[model samples]
Structures are given as C-alpha cells and as structure tokens.
Target: MKSSFLKKHFTFVFFIVFLLFSFKASAQKVRPIKSDQGEVVTMHSDILKEDRRILIYAPKDSANSEKKYPVIYVLDADNHFAQMVEYSKYLSRQDVFVIPPLIVVGITNTDRNRDLTPSHSNVDYFGKSDTTANSPYKNSGGNEHFFQFIQKELMPYVSSNYKTQPYRIFAGHSFGALTTINCLINYPDMFDAYIAVSPSFWWDQKFLLKLADKKLKAGSTLSKTLFFSDGNEDSSSPGSPFHTDVLKFDSLLKKRNIKGLDFEYMTYPAESHMTVPIKSYYDGLRFIYHQWQLPPVSDEKLNPEIVMKHYKGLSQKFGYLILPDEAYFNDLAQWLVKKPATLNNGIKLLEMNTVNYPSSSRAFTALGAAYVVKGEKQNAIASYKKASELNPTSNEIKSRLKELQK
Candidate 1:
C-alpha cells in the first residue's frame, strides 16, 4: 500500500512540473528596452579656437515633420544636458503638453573658469584674492569670447542645420548662470529667454551686480523671459554671499522697472547647491511657460475654432508658429465626438490636423475612424484609402479600407 501511494504522489508531482514547463514554453518573451537618445556633433569654433562638442537632442517624433521647434542652449552640457532633454520631452508630451517641442543644444566646456566668468579676476568665490601661479581662477574672464562663439558660430550652425524657430533660450548654472545673466544685460537681443540657476554673482567681487546696474537703464525694454533662482547656499557663512547676491540682483531688477521683462525669482531653502538644479530647472521652465497650458473649455462651447485661436495667440506670445500636437488633437477630437452636438466640431479639428500634418498616416487613420462614427461611409472610405496609401505596409489600415469598401 505504501509503494502504491508513493507512485501516485510522484505521478502528481511530475504532472505539475510538466504543466509548468508547458506554460513557460508557451509564454512570449520580451527583451529589455534600450534607450539611446541624443546626438553628439563636433563643430569647430573659430572664435574659441577649439573644436566644440555639441550635444543635440531633438524631439524623438520630430523626424516625421518639417515643423520648426524652439531651441534651448544650455551651458555645462556634461552636467545638465540630459536633464534638460528629459524635461523637454516630458513637458512636450501629448498628455502633459505644458511647453512646445524643443531642440536642446548642450554646449560643453573646454575651460570652465575661462569660458564662464565675466571678468578676468584672481578673486575667488569667498571674496578672497588668490594671485598664486596655480590659482583655480587663473584662466578666468572669457565670457565675451564665449558669447561671440555662441552668437556668431554656434547659433548659426544650429539654426541652419536644424528646423529651429526664432525663439531661443540661454540656460546655465553657477558661473554659467553668471554668464547667462551677463549675456542678457550686455546682449539683450541674444536670446528670447534666460535661465540662471544659482548664478555665481560673487565672482569678481559682485562685478555682475555692478554691470547690471550700468546696463539695465531706467525703464529699459528687455522684452524677454528670465527665470533665476538660488538654493540655501547660506547654510554656512562660507556660502552666504551666493544667497545674498541673487537677492540683490532681484532687487535691482524691481528697481529698474524694465519693460516687457517677464521674470521670476525663486528660493529653495531645503536644497543644497548640488541638488538645487533639478528643482530649480523644473520650476524655471514652468515659470517661463506659466501661461502655456490651454484654459479649460466648457463642453457646451467646445469648438475647434477656439482651439485654433488659442494656438494662434500662443504663436504670437512665443514669437513662433505653435501648433497643437497631432496625437493630442486626435485624442481630443475623439473625446469631443462622443456627443452629437460636438461631432462636426470634432471632425473640423481632425481636418485641421490633416492640414497641419498632411503626411501623417496616423492622422488620416484617426480622421477615418471619426468619419466612420459619424456614419459618413464615403468619407471614411476615402480617408482610409489615403491612410493605406501613405502606409502601404500597414495591414490594419488595409483591413479598415477593405471593410469600408465592402
């Protein structure tokens, strides 16, 4: 009886193992997703007299269209490039849609002190003069040359090579922040926007503060957006000036009464210098594009014309032709078409997309699906046919067309 019982138990265990093996064999496998984003381009700078390594990150979906996008030129590419790229990606996503798509050009530094400082000085951050032979600030004060390189060589190269809009942003941190603010003061027309995170205003005994006083005249017109912020650098006496200097700069701007200068100053007490950038950058972008998101539309008055007008106003505000994302338009149209009252409005929105994105198979597919719901059989068939022709390899589009034809 014991031997019989043991054989039955072994049989049951083997059956369970067989079933597990069968399930494992039948299941589909998935590989890990590898993300290799951005492109590295080497460009020679005549003014700087060195080959500059430029890290360029365009919207991943931008390859399909000839649309131009705003550009952000970030100083300290090695430290901040990828972070900017990711931020741009998330903000410009179809769902989030806070900012328009951007082309981020990250300019790396060959000489940190030389390129980022505004004036040649042996004075360190702590208001102490170091005239030693091996001082860290020996090669300082090349901000003018750096700006020349950016304005003359770098900007032109990016503009010519990439589909870029007229609006541009200059972003930096620490001495890089000082450089950006200096550029804004001296070269106001250089960029449409400026972002200075924890600018090293203590450089050269607060030379930038003095310069700002001189350059930013009474009621001068800046006509630009500037977002600058600082962390709790005053946690110790050694770094207190960083906090105070930014405060002074903010006060100067308020006193100057600069016209058309949309700016914001933020303070992050919990963050240290090293960690402040992440929060500062995120908030800076939000501040720069504070009024970017579309206002809520009532379901009763939901119409494509309102959407169109909103984007036109955005284009005017941003100084560029801003269009709604194609995917978002499709999703919005589908949502709008749920009620009979807004069906034609939804159709009109999709039509606007077809006009904006003439070559997108997905756009046509979406339009066709909308037409099908509207019971416009002929229109749906024609839209499906166009989509299939655009994407000949798409069996799904072909199937839709075939069903519509039948």
Candidate 2:
C-alpha cells in the first residue's frame, strides 16, 4: 500500500514538473527580426500653417553610418511613398548598384488641391468652372506657399535631423507633377534634378504649358536634369489633348536647345494615369543618374584610379564630395585578388577602404583575406586582429585568426 501511494505521488510530481516546464517554455520570449526599412516623422510647418508628416527611408547598412545620402523630396507621399522606398532600396543594392542609396522623404498631403495647384481656378481639367459652394478648386493656387513650406520649414528640418547631401531631387505625379515643373522653372536652384510623372498640363487651361514657353528661352543656360513622362489617359483617341499637351511641352524644351538643360521625356502607352508613376519613377531615377554607374569591364582593365576618377566627376556634378561605396570597393578588391596581375591593386583598394571606412569590420576582414592571398601572413594576422576587435562576436573572424596564428 505504501509503495502504491509513493508511485502515485511520484507520477503526480513528474506530471507537475512537466507542466511547469511546458509553461516556462511557452512564456519565454522570442526575439523578432527587425526591418531597417524606414520610419515616419512629424513636424509643424509654419509656412503651410499646419503639421506635416514626412516618411524617411534610409539605407539598412549600419557600416555606412557616417555616410551622407542624397535626398529625394517626393510629393503625394500617401500614394507613392512605399513604392519609392522599395525602388530605392532595391536599385541601390551592391549587386545592382545602378544608383546610390537615396534618402527618400515622402511629403504627405494635407490639402492636395491647394498645395499642388499653382493657380486658383474655378475651371476644372475639362475646362468647366465649378461655381458651387462645395467646389474643390475653392482652395487651390497655393503652390508658392507650398514651395515656401518645403524651402523654409521642411528642408531645414530634414537637414537638421538627417545626414543629407547637398544634392536634392524633386519628384511628383499628376497635379504634384505640375508643381514640380513650376518649381523647376521658377526655383531651378532648389533641386539638382526634377521628375514629373504625368503632369497635369491641362490644369487652369494649360497655364503651366504657357509658363514653360515663357520661362525657357532659346540657348538659355539652365544647368539641371529633368525627367518627365505621360501615360495613356484617353485610350479611345490617340490624338487626345491629354497626351498632346505633354508632347507640346517636350517639343518646347527640345526646340529651344536650352544650354545645360539635360532632359528626357517618356511615354507609357500601356499604363494609365495612376499606373504610369511606377515605371516613370524607375526610368526617371535611371535617367537622372545615367552616368553615375560604372560599366562592367574585364578584370585586366580594372583600376582603382579609374574608380576614383569616375566618382570625382560625379562629385563635381553633384556639388558634393562623393566617394565610391565601401561595398563597391570591397567587391572590386575581391575580384582583383583572384588574378596574379591585379593582386597588388586589390590590396591597394582594400587599404583605401580601411582609410575610408575605419569602423567597418567587414572591410578589415576583406583586407585580411586579400593579404592571405598575397602570402603575407603577418599583414593578414594584423588585419584579422583589427577585424576581430571590431566584431568580437564574429566566429568567422575568430576562426580565421586562429587558422592564421597556427
């Protein structure tokens, strides 16, 4: 009987312990994988007389913490912010380094009609005036004030809070595109590049089209990059004025041959008014930075000086000191180390990275690997030591150092 009682007690105790362990395991927290996409921030705007929201998307690479990125101020943030962020992130990847990682500041709208429209007009897009009490055009023609908001309030706020370069891009769509073109003509110096996707040139009876004709003079010097596009708005008729107006604007810019004005116009016949922005934004970025990318070349022709020269020209154009990305240099170094002739150049490029990015453990690791390839044991050990010091938790660095030490 006592054995029977003891067996029952032991079973109950084991069951309780198992239940406790299960409960404890269930209660334990799991660490979540965090995304470095971006964050939304708010600021009060005295120029607009309202609070504004700005979405900022930055590069995820923590190694380039000290790097200052070019800023893109995009209008109609509510509709296009996510798309821009994704595009910037993907296009600036190390594998597809067509464009540098950009800081995209998406400006959310409070009053779309008022802020985006350049002139107050009772007349709508169809050339019909709305005299009703609830007319949407009642609060239009605030583009100047909107520009002031961006210049005085928004720009200062972004510059103060973020690591931004002097180079800036202005991007907008439809009505927002109209504002961008207006800014381009009136305030050319505000941005280095301008992107207008399906601009509503038909607004206020084509006031902006006439303004463009007046502002852009023949043989005039307007040293800026401009990319504008139009989509198929009226599929029923190819001769519709919706697309014709854009053609007129394009012709006006082209015929004048405005000195220093770099511009490209694209037409997406398959896309509609709302869908054109996706392709146009992508093409616009590619067009503006067409010269920024380094073309692929044979390993024999690869030279660090050539890389430096390319970036120097880019720096001159951007009006800022630009350096080749750490990843780009590192990749070039790795490629160079594979060949006997380019081994020294590879080491040199890696050394340059150590100077440019002193805090990067991966840079030092890559340099160490290059030194190992060159049969320089002591140099490799030193580089690995520096890398290990920077990243103490890295088992790969630890193993590399151990293997080299042996």
Candidate 3:
C-alpha cells in the first residue's frame, strides 16, 4: 500500500511541474526594467521663505533594516545629482565594496548666485565687473542665510524622516564650489567633509582665499576632509586666474598645515570646466575613504574577530558605531564552509552574525545551515526552531525543522 501511494504521489507531482513549465513556455510577456529612481521631496522652508524641492537616493538595503547611512549634499542637482547617486550606488556594491552605503541629498537651487556666494558683488568670472541692472550676481551674498536654511529646515527634515548617520558631506561646482569653501570657513561644523570642483576662487578678487587664511589659523585644529580640484579653464597659459587661484589656495593650505585638516588638491589640465566633475567627483570619493577597503585574509586566518575588528576601526575613524552587514557575514560564512579546512571557522562566523543580529530570522537560518554542514543535527534543529519562531510565516524554516526532527 505504501509503495503504491508513493508511486501515485510522485506521478501527480511530476504532472503538476510539467504543466507549469509548459504554460510558462507558451505564454511570455515583454517586461520593462524596474526603475531605480529615488524620491522627490518638497518642504516649505521658513528661512528661505519658499518651497524647496530636493532629491534623495538611499541604499535599497536600508529598507526594513536598522542600518543608518551617511549623507552627501549635492549642489547643482539638475546636473550632478544623478552622477553622485550613481557613484554612491556603484562604490558601495558588494562586489566593489570600497565605501559604505551613502544617502545622497540633492538640493535644488532657487537663486544660484544669491545662495552660493559669500560676498555681494557685481563682478562675474574672468574678473569682469558687470554693473548693469540685470547682472546675475546682483542677488548674491545670501550664503549665510542659505546655510541657515539647510541647518534649520533641510537637515532637520532629513533626520526626522530618514535613518541617517552623524557624518555629512557637502559638494559643489563653480559658484557652488565657492559656496562649499565658504561653508567650510564659516560653518565648519555643518558637515564633516567637503568636495569643491573648479571653484570660482577669483570671485570678488579672491575673497574666499583671503578669508581662508584668516579663519583657518595656522596650526589650528580643523579636523575635516576637503577634496578640491580645478579644470583647464584656459589655465594652461599665463595669467589664468582660475588655475592660478586654486594653486595659490593649495599653497596656503600647505603652508598653514592646519592640524587635523585632511585635504587633497588636483588639477585636470586635459578636462574643461564642464567635464572635470566626472573624474573629479570619482577621485574625490575614493580619496575620502582611502582606507575603507578590508585587507585580504587567507581562509586559514579569516575569523569573525577579524571582521568585527575591521568594522570597529572604521567606526572609530568615522565617529560612529559601524557593524558588518548581516548579509555580508552570512555570505562569507557559507563560502568558508565549502572548504573542510575552514569549516569550523565558518560556523564561528555564522555564530557572530547571530550575536550581532539576534532578531534576524535570516541570520538564524544561515546559522542552521552551517550547523547542518557540521552534521550537528540537534544544533541545526534548535537554530531552525528559533528562526521559525522569529518568522512564523517562513515555510522553508518549518520544513527544514520538520525534516531534522523526523
């Protein structure tokens, strides 16, 4: 009777699988790719007295997870927001894990000149003073108020609505770059790092340069990261104030040698003002997290302690409590257990994930699989039971537990 029932059940299961495959093979649909776009948000700002539009790109992994991400504020969102979002996504990929997942906030401009300049001036780039009634620089020198808008409205909104780390980065180009440097000098505590691409240092006859010397006192402690670069801008020949001004700023930074001021300066002679941001932003991000990559470890030496210690070092450097992602540890452990030499070490790695994320059903499920590899059926049963309790709807966990019990 048992043999007859088994034969019939196998036939029925095979017939059902065949029918499903045949249906899928006969019917097909052209599918569009899922959009990988971020959210567009608008908030009314009392400081600016306008409805500010912004773009936000957060890591997908942040959803339904307790992970918090650092933020980078991008100026000229119309042009550079997508680029920074792509950089943040690609650099933090599992395969190319050089930096942590970042949340990018692209701040759109209401008045470009008024918000991005430090001083009121009718002068334009190339040292030409446009004193006409319609000068673009007429609405300039509201940078201090711009900073207030960010601090009072934008930053608070992001913090209240999203999971964010304490570290923040400010980035810009041209006039926006000038604004970034001005923020560094005046509102130093607003952001931890700053990126400036081809800043109009010649604005107001080198006003920011003079201010940098005065505000950034010699040997003072301004423990911040700054990456500034300039493009050709016809700077190859003599009397190119655009390139010369940046060189002078670099000289001043080197001369002052402000304590704890980590900075880098690069000049891209081949690139024009319009094209330098491509390479400049990429290199700037790499420079910011220069030591973020984990050192290579042989399987024999790889252990949970080493992984934990690596993240701890990063936490100290970034002034936040950084922990290894649960998925990363689970993958590493599974790979380790594939080889007999590292089987026990792999189990240890899985155990560490449980300690770090006790409430995670996935972590517990992974640990159970590692125990199964070691032929510890009782331990595996216990792990699956805990996982099932944490996630009662998981049929896979229930089936695994039943199989082990039987």
Leading candidate by TM-score: 3
Give the Å error, residue 170, model 2. Answer: 0.7
Clashing pairs in 3: none
Candidate 2 TM-score versus the reference:
0.86
Write one digit per residue (lDDT tens) for candidate 2, span 77-146. Answer: 9999888888898898888888988999999999999999999898986778997989998999999999
Candidate topping lDDT = 2
Cand. 1 TM to true fold: 0.88
Q: Please give, for residues 1-406, the per-residue lDDT of candidate 3 as tens digits.
A: 9999999999999999999999998898878987565899988888888888999988766313767899999999989999999999899887787888899999998898999899999886666888788999988899999999998889998999888999999999999899999999998999999999999988888899999988888888998999999999965445777888899999999999899899999999899999999999998899899878768988889888898899899888888988887777688889998899999988999999889888888888999998999999999999999899999998999999999999
TM-scores, all models, native as reference: 0.88, 0.86, 0.89
Candidate 1: segments with Cα more than 4 A from true spot: 1-33, 338-342, 388-395
Model 2 alpha-carbon drift over 4 Å, by segment: 1-36, 236-239, 339-342, 385-406
lDDT per model, in order? 0.88, 0.91, 0.89
